[model samples]
Target: MCVQLQAKDLLEQPIWRTAELIKQSKRHVAAPDGYVSSFIDFIELHGGEIVTAASSCRVTSGFTDWRHLGQMGVDFGWGNPVTVLPLSTRRLLGSDEPCFFLPHSSVGEGKGDGGFKVLVLLSEAAMPGFKIEIDKFCSQEFGQL
Candidate 1:
């Protein structure tokens, strides 16, 4: 489900509140009676508005949480995956940049590092700044990069 937040709402509300609102909205959408019956119905009702809104946006980012997907345990005739990576393309959401929250590699049955991994895709021009910020964050969090 896609939840769109207005800039004004984001700026006006605290981040935790915004996140709760999004979670509530997602739950509402996921309810059995919350959705349209068909794609045609959805398009007829909201397609034009969606297109216009998308056109007005200069930048868009997408995020997906795959931590619950158990991707690391998927074995392809070898062993559990050492790492899970997302494709750089964002055709799924039409985002310019995308971030994926992935599960940590499995060490054994019901065992893992108890941490997650984030895979981010960004423009080449943004990489340096992103790296610097990430380094800063790492140093602050763990006392080293």
Candidate 2:
């Protein structure tokens, strides 16, 4: 969304369009274009640990698309989530799936940083860049590796 690339073009993109992309996603190694695991690696390097991770599609009962929750920002509330970015150094999912951290009604009341948690309805395309942004912030603010 930042550079104007459509969602489908980002998420469901065919590997043929970018040959190295397929090569990178293969089992033994990761390509430079890897978005998900890179974020996880960046996070762990910086000491920001993953608190929880799960697939919203499988573990959540959100009952709403959640995007509409963004409207709460008018009253100082975080709206809905649009997607999830998997952050795993392993470059794949096994029994444990991706964790979704999105805008929730109680962001500031939590135990550690005070931000609350909620799962949002989202597409896969939006996650890569999103992961980059959050990981970048963690590195900048907390001196994460």
The per-prediction tally of clashing pairs is 0, 11
Query: Distance (Å) between predicted and true CA of 112, model 1?
Result: 1.4
State each model's C-alpha RMSD to the native. 4.6, 17.7
Candidate 1 error regions (>4 Å): 6-12, 35-53, 106-111
> Per-residue lDDT for 95-132 in model 1, tens only?
77767888875655546757887878888989999999
What TM-score would candidate 2 get against the native? Answer: 0.21
Off by over 4 Å in 2: 1-115, 118-120, 142-145
lDDT score, candidate 2, position 71: 39
Superposition error at 113 for model 2 (Å): 8.5
What lDDT would candidate 1 get against the real structure?
0.71
Best by lDDT: 1
